[model samples]
Target: MTANLSTPPAIPAGTLPAGTLAAAPQPRLPAPGGLLLRPWAAADATVFLAAYRDPEIGHWHTRQPASADQVREWFDRYGADWAREKGAHWAVTGGGGEVLGRIALRGIDLDDGVAVCAYWVLQAARGAGVASRALTAVSAWALGGAGFHRLELDHSTRNRASCRVAAKAGFLLEGVKRSAAVHSDGRHDMHLHARVRDDGPPA
Candidate 1:
C-alpha cells in the first residue's frame, strides 16, 4: 500500500470524526500553561547558552557551553536549515517568558514516515511536564502536517530524566544498544524508544 507522502495522518489528543485524520489541520496547539512553542530567533541565543551552562546538561550533550561567536554561527545555520526544511528546531518558553528547553525534529523521512525527536530542558524545568507538552505539540504537527508515522528518541543510559520524559511523551521502551558511543571515560549504553502513529495516548 502507498503511504500518504503529502500529509501525515493526524492522531488527535481528543476524539474526532472517522475521517478527521485525513481532514483539515488540527486546532493550533498551545504549550502547557499557555507556554509558547515556536521557532528560535537569533536573540534567543542567550537563553540557549544559559541553559547549556548547567554541568548536568553538558554531561549528556556533547557540545559544551557555546561561545558568543559560536552561538551566532549556530543560529545562522539553524535558521538556514529550517528555511530549507532540512530539519527544524523550536524554543520552549513559559507564559512568564522563561526559556524552558528546545525540541527538534531532525532526520525527517517523509517516505518512511519517521523522524527523530530530541530535547533538553533546564534543571528548573525538570518534572514540570514541559518536555512532554512540547513533544506532544510537535508530534501532532509532524503526524498531521509533515507525514511522519514514527518518532524515535535516544539518550545515554545514564540520562534517567530523559528516559522518563520519553515515557511521559508516550514512547515505549524498544531496546538498548550497548557501548552506543565512547564517553569521557569509556563506552556508554544507549536507550532507544519510539512512538508509533497507532500508539494510544501521549502524556
Candidate 2:
C-alpha cells in the first residue's frame, strides 16, 4: 500500500487590496446634488472655523476650534491619519470649492469590519439634505470600494436633525446606548444607526 503526500501551491500573503481595511488613499467620491468629497486641507481652516461657529455644530462637536492655529494642527493630524491608513476624513464641498461640511469614517475595526461615520453641515447648508447626501455617498464608497462591512453612526437622541440625516442616509436605527456619550451640552443617550455590507441598495 502506498500513499501520496503532495504539497499544494502556496497562497499569496501580505498582498492586501487597496481602498479597504487599511487606508491607502482617499479616492474621489462624488456626492451628487452639487457636492464633492475631498480631503481636508490646511487652507480650509477659515471655513472650518466658520462652521464651528454654528450653534448646532458647537453644541454637537464639543471641540470648537478657537483659532486657525488649532485648525492647522487638526489638519496635520488628519493628514497623518490618512497616510498611516488609520482613517479617512473629507470636506464636503461645492462646485466652486466652497466648504459646506465634514464627513469622516473613523474608529475603524478591521476585526469586525466596522467603522464609525461622523458628519456635520454648516448652518447655511442645514435642511438642504447636505449631511444626508454626503453621508450616503461616503458610506457607499466605504462599503463598496473601501471594503468595510459595517458602518456605524451615533448621535445624541436630542439631536433631531442628525437623526433625520442618519435616517435619510439609510442607516438602520439600531437602538440606543444609554449615557454612552458626553456631548458639549451634556451626557446623552446615543442613538446608534448602522448599515452593513449586505444591507442591499442604499435608500
Q: What is the lDDT of residue 146 in candidate 1?
A: 54
TM-score per model over all chains: 0.80, 0.87
In model 1, the worst 10-residue window by lDDT is 19-28
On lDDT, the leading prediction is 2
How close to the true structure is residue 73 of candidate 1, measured as C-alpha lDDT?
80
Count clashing residue pairs per candidate.
0, 0
lDDT of 1 by residue, 131-187 (tens): 988888887777655556788988889878888888887889899988886645567
Looking at model 1, the pairs that clash are none
The TM-score, computed over Cα atoms with residue i paired to residue i, of candidate 2 is 0.87
